[model samples]
Target: MVDLYTHILPNVEKGPRDVNAFLTMAKSLVDQGVKNVVASPTYNGQDLEKQNIMLYVEAANKHLQHAFIPLTILPGQKVTIHYRLIQAFEQNVHLPINHSTKYMFLQLPNENTDVLNEQILYELQLKGIVPIINEPERHPTFLEDSDLLYEIVKRGAIVQLSSDSIVGKNGRKEKKAALTFIDKGLAHIIASGVCADTYESYTLPKAYDMVSRQFGTQILYKFMENADYIVEGKAIFKEQPERVKKGKFLGIF
Candidate 1:
């Protein structure tokens, strides 16, 4: 499965010791059967953070062109697109894309979001860029406003649900919200936003398997296949044969 979201800090030195902490974390995932991972930088880092991201992007792009299952780098950050981003755009500091990098992974604030978030997405759309909000389950405000979530998808923004939510790693509240979104067909993708132990933690294969066992294989497969599409930059739509109700489970497959 393609892990659509991850964080891997680059190693500045050579060999294994040269890489950052997250690389060691990611190495564990590789041992667990995760073939591809789309990684990005953390919100905070020191010098050459941008350069590190670029290195990952450039390297991955070259490998992907040859069908090599190299770890892919999405490179965009979690921070808001403020003066710095705008200035970078003005100076063309961002990586040039070819109809693909149009999709960006946005990390929303863990707490409630204001109208500015909506504006940020709107502006991104205006620039022909689609914002894929990561881990909506962590944001309580989103669960409180399902209509707003629907609106975001309606306006062409995609929601990425974390795989751990199904197994309750994110806590009961996040699990419930994730189920709500999936049962209602509001979620289009599920990724193991795993940091460490690729084999043990954030392993999509195991997490989804457990979910399939409990929730039935159909629900699990729906998210599994949809996850593939999201990584390929395909648009996923809500697929419900009937209306969804709270506290009720729907057949997902």
Candidate 2:
């Protein structure tokens, strides 16, 4: 399974202890049996925004060589916001992406609606780049107004929810929002936004199980197809099961 998003700092190589700490954290994810992890650099509140993304990408690749089969680089939002985001579109030039990479991951401001985010996505689409937004539910504004989620999907952005949100690790509200979006068919993928060793948080496989039980096994495939198409630059939803889950269950008498 492909666990989508994580924040592996680039400056971890600053010292021996730092390198060891990062490897230990990364290996823990591998120990949990993840096949591949797509990671982006964090940039919530920092002076060195996008300063360490390149290093993070390099670190992910290095760790993946020994831990997983296919290491995917989720271009941190700092990279997107600072450069490479609207470059070709803004300049009207055709540029080829790095030979090894295909997709870019971005984070939204906690307080903005999907409108500005859509503009960014449209710019990316115009430039022929597929942008995947990370953890939309974590955005305070998005949570306050769920309809924005549907609107974002209406535009060309794929929404990734954290695994912890899926199984109620974040809270009942987060879990409900996540499931509601899934039920409405808005959310496209589940990523393990792992920060540290926390047993209460949902792992990728466990989240998959919970989603399968709540929705269906077929939705899982649809989610994967969404990720694949975005990375592959496809503009259509992959063919899916015609039958959608119906008939809610009630507690036993």
Candidate 3:
């Protein structure tokens, strides 16, 4: 499977600290049956950071070949939804998934506001970039108001749900939200490596098996296909998202 979000690059978020640490983390993903992973460091719109991301991706891929590891690491970032991201894009930085200018992973903080909400996403869409927001299931703002996410999805943003969250590794609230997103057709992709601190390396694979059992293969296959498309830089399949009731379970068991 393809993991669209990971911090396997050193100095990129809390993935790994050094080359050795990176290998160790990558090995964990390999052991979990993940063949490809996108390295998502926390980007802040700097040319130097872009260079470093490219540098680490090349170096890490070489190391994988030299060490006989079969896993491939793709280049990507979990860019914070700052206003400057607009300027950065205008300046020619392709903050996209797997180096593809079509899709990009843009993250919103807990305290999301108007700037982080509709405006930037609309702007990105105007440029033909489909912004993929990671783990809205765990965001306090989104949890408090599920319609917020529906509105964003209606505006053309894709949702990437965290596997561990759906696996109930984060907490009950996160689990409920994660499953609800899938039930409502809001989630377009599933991935791991939200953070090294919450790393239960096996949960991603476990989540797939368990979710496929509980929710059926239709939902499972859609997100899985979307992951592959993101890596390949092609258009992904998105369901017509159904709006969620404020306090109901939304049919998610």
Candidate 4:
């Protein structure tokens, strides 16, 4: 399986802290049946590694090869949303998934202004970058007002639901929101969080199974295939996003 959002890079904030952690993460992913990963490290926080992401990917690939781990690492970055995201990409300050210019993993701020969020989402798409917003289910803004999420996705920004959210690791509220997003056609991709570790390795398969059981195999396949497309820098699949009705998920709000 291809796990798009991963932190297996050594020393990157969410990746293994050292050589031992690196091997441990590699084995954990392999054990979880993941054959490929996009080595996405968060860059917003002070300690998160933003530059030299390719170097991290290289070191991780080398480690996997030497250690006989079967997982392959791809270059990626997780950036917090801001007005300058497009400029940053143009400056080559951060990487898109698999080093492609097509897709990026975007993390929404905890506090969101609807106008600003929509504008950035629109502006990113205009720059030919599909901002795949990460884990909207767990974000307070989206949790309180699902329409904001609906409109952002409607404007062509992709949604990446986290596996932890789907499997109830984040909480029941997030899990409910994740499933509802799928049901409402508001979410396009599902992946592990930017931080990769042994504890998270098991959630992907379980999320897949849960989604398949609830929504059938085709939706499952679409999510899986979309991940591959992002890696190849190609267009992603999408269904017309429908507004998640108000009060449908009030408990989460």
lDDT of 4 at 144: 82
Better of 1 and 4 by lDDT: 4
Q: Point out the worst 10-residue segment of candidate 4 by lDDT.
A: 193-202
Per-residue lDDT over 142-208 for candidate 2, one digit per residue giving the tens place of the 0 to 100 score = 6666666566666666667888887777777677767766776667787776654452343777888
| Candidate with better TM-score, 1 vs 3 | 3
lDDT of 1 by residue, 1-253 (tens): 6676655434422112233444445446656666666664444222234555667656544644454434444544443344244345445444322225566666665554556667777877788777777777777667665666777777777777887886778788788777767666677677776553333455467667766776688877777776565556665544642234443422233
Kindly state the number of residue pairs that clash in model 4.
Answer: 0
Q: Please give, for residues 94-129, the per-residue lDDT of candidate 3 as tens digits.
A: 557777658888878656786566888999999899
TM-score of each model, paired residue for residue: 0.71, 0.71, 0.92, 0.92
Which pairs of residues clash in candidate 1, taking residues 3 or more apart in a chain or in different chains?
11-19, 28-198, 29-198, 29-199
Task: State candidate 1's TM-score.
Answer: 0.71
- The local distance difference test score of model 3 is 0.80
User: What are the per-residue Cα lDDT tens digits for candidate 4 across 1-253?
Assistant: 8988876778767666898778887788788788898877776643334458777788778988999999899988888876676667677786778876588888887667677777777777787788888888898888888988887887778899989888888998889999999998999888876454444446888899989999999999999998888888888889988887777764432
